[model samples]
Target: MKILQIINSLDTGGAEKLILETIPLFNKRNVQTDLAVLNGFDYPFLKILKKLNCCSIFSLGNKSVYNPFLIFKIRPLLKNYDIVHVHIFPSLYWVALAKMLSFSKVKLVYTEHSTSNNRRKRFIFKILDKFIYSFYSKIITISPEVDTNIKAHLKYNNDKFVLVQNGINLDTIKNEKPISKKELLPNLENDSYILTQVSSFRYPKDQKTVIKSLKKLNDNVVLVLIGDGPLRNECEVLVEELNLSKRVFFLGIRMDVINILKASDIIILSSHHEGLSLSSVEGMASEKPFIASDAPGLGDIVRNAGILFPINDDSSLAKEISKLLENSEHYQETVTKCLKRANDYSIDKTITKEINLYKSLLEK
Candidate 1:
């Protein structure tokens, strides 16, 4: 069977990363998986996918990710695959509309990647979302929180919803050698501690909280922010205004994320909410003491295994980081728990479930 995974862009995000990691594995199973994007930008993930040369890549030939006119362009592409699996917004709506307009028999599958979004805040979007979601044969949720939230938002109960938490290739992370501390931060002392957060500066992500928390920590502690988005400039200004220009490093986007994660003393994810953050899982798999905000998607994964602070509470976050630093035994224990938890969500297991779901849908 042939499958086509559609998304807005191969930018720096969990959903985009999922597509990059899964496409090759799907093809290896002889499922003939491919990819299509609404916006064909020259992002770092797009470059990596091209280098892999594992599957065909299709672009809608538009720079803008959310052109309503994309529906017309996507309609024709729907006929070429047995299943068209979609991720993220605008692309989800566009592909659903495209399926309805073309009257294609191909099944449409959507992976809901977040527990919350702006669209859900408005009453009018509830109606619009229900209509759009009706077009899909199955909706895969990345976490239990995501599944429950989407069901409540739609106010519909049905068998179409499936729980399949996001996964990462653990072996890749384990095998990658950590970049030396000197190379990562030349100005800092060799014994200085590094706190890394690998997430795009988007609305759902709270890099500001992380930045504020850094002020509470000791001067020897440094913060490294990876990934980029519209809010990155605003974050830079905050770092400058807070006089943390020297302490905070904005690395933008880097392909060697696993290596950086390995080199860090602690991994952090201060997000407002998540639909099972792949970064959180990756941080855990990197064998670091993962610290995250006690938000829905994140809290569920991090509570017992890693560390969780009150949402947006920089003081509490600072205290948690201090605890890890002060107690070596506690730090090692947290790392052991996180590494064990990370093993539960292996990429191989997730892909097997996804492949079965696709096969089951087609059989019907």
Candidate 2:
């Protein structure tokens, strides 16, 4: 079946990376797949998509589904593609709009990568995740929590949502040697304990919590905040307020996350909520234990692999950090558990399951 994956921008993020990884899987199965990037196509992941024979269509789809010209633009393309799969929310807006305008019968699939509790995103684009989602051919979520969370949005008997947990490519990260901490930052050496987090500084993926948690750390651990977003300056300001300038390292948008994960001693995630964080998954794959918030999606994955603290509790987070640092036995135990659990998120498993899902959906 010819498939068209719709996305807002082919930028770097969990959703972007996940979509990029899926294109090859479709190609391997001889499925003709193309992409609909709602904006610019210059992202590194999008560049790779072009190489994979995925056609890029610049969509006028924006934050709202009211992009009147989008349907006119996308309607013509739907004549050939059999399916239109949307990744993320705003893109879903366009897919839903385009499906309404399509002259041909194209299967509409929407994947919910994050929970709808996103305050900032919701303020402007309140996700119409109501029963209208039932209009789609199939619904997919990245974690069980997301599937469970849908109950609050839809009435009973909305249909069973497919739970496709985020997958990790062990082969991609395993054998590669880690970039030494000194080489990447060119400052700290063996004396530094690099505690890193990969996240776009957004309200839900609470980078401020991590910055706050850093201030309470008993040790002189280096805090590395990777990835960029609106909250970058806010996090920096918090670091300054706490006088953590020397300790906090704000390295925005590093593509080589696995290499950094490998080099770091510990990873930290203080997201107020999540839908299966790709960064934490990569950290587990890299055998680095993390200190993540006890929120949905993330809490389930980091259960045994890392220490969990209350979402908004700085004291509890500080206590957990101290526990990990002081207790060598527990630290090693968490690491061992994390490494073993990482295998559960293997790329082969994710790819195989997704292909099966696609085939099943197509057959119906």
Candidate 3:
């Protein structure tokens, strides 16, 4: 079967990374897969996708959101594939319109990657979203929270939505030697307790809370942020204002994130919200004790595996890190539990479920 995966951009994020990891699995099953991005950008993942023979990449040119020409550009391409799977927002708008305009017979599938979209609450968008979703053969939610969120807003049948938890490629992060502090950041002291958070600086991702927690933690602890975004400047200023220049390190957009995860003593995610965070799962798969905000998507993944602190509570976060740092047995137990939990969301299991879903829909 031929599948076309569409997204707004091929930039870095959980959805993009998950889709990239998933392409090879589809190919292994002798399924032809291709990717389409509304706007083009150079990213590390693009290089990885180029190496996969089973995949072909396409772009709708560097088009603006207002570009009415986009639908015409994508319409012809939709006919060649048996299924068109869309990820991320706005792509939904374009795909919904293209499917209508072209009268395409291809199966339309969508994965709602987030638990919340504020636009869903608006009345105009409510009508638009309902209409858009009606064209979808099935809606795959990355977590139960996402499923519940969609049902709350969109007028879709219960049978229309399917729960397919996001999974990670364990091999990508496993069995890597962690680069030492001296190698990456020489300013860090020999005894510094590494606390890492790998996420883009944006809303719902409260890196500020993590930054604040650093001031309360022991001086021996260092906070390493692994991704970059709009809120980065604000985060940088907060780090300076807290006088944590040496204590907090911002290593912006590194391709070698797994190695950074390997170097960390523990991983923490201080997010206001999430839908099964890839960073948390990757940390768990890296054999490190994962600490995360006790919010819906994150809580679901870290429940029996690692530690959780109340959202935006820096004291609670600091305490969890300190406790784990002080106790070797507790730390090891958490690590073991995390690895086990990570196994549940392996790429192999995710691929099997996805392929089965696609085949079942095609059979009908």
Best by lDDT: 1
Alpha-carbon lDDT of model 2: 0.75
What TM-score, to 2 decimals, does candidate 2 have?
Answer: 0.90
Candidate 3 collision pairs: none
lDDT of 3 by residue, 1-364 (tens): 9999999876778998998899978888888888988886667777778766558889788757446678888899899999999988888878889999999899999999888867877889888899988989999988888889888888578999888888988876776778876888887788888989999898889999889988778899998998888999999999999999988999988888888888889998989888778888998988789999998789988998899999989999988988999999999999999999998888888888888889999999
Candidate with best TM-score: 1
Candidate 1 clash figure, as a count: 0
The all-Cα superposition gives candidate 2 an RMSD in Å to the true structure of: 2.9
lDDT of 1 by residue, 1-364 (tens): 9999999999889999999999999999999999999998878889899999999998887568778899998998888999999999999899988888899999999999999999999989888999999999999998989999999998767697999988999889989999988898889886689999999998889999999998999999999999898999999999999999988999999999999999999999998899989999999999899999999898889889999999989999999999999999999999999999999889998999999999999999
Q: Write the per-residue lDDT of candidate 2 for residues 208-232, one digit (tens) a residue.
A: 7777877777456778888888878
What is the lDDT ranking, best to worst? 1, 3, 2
RMSD of 3: 1.3
Query: Which is the better candidate, 1 or 2, if ranked by lDDT?
Result: 1
Q: How much is 187 displaced in model 3, in angstroms?
A: 2.2
Instruction: Supply candidate 3's per-residue lDDT for 175.
Output: 67
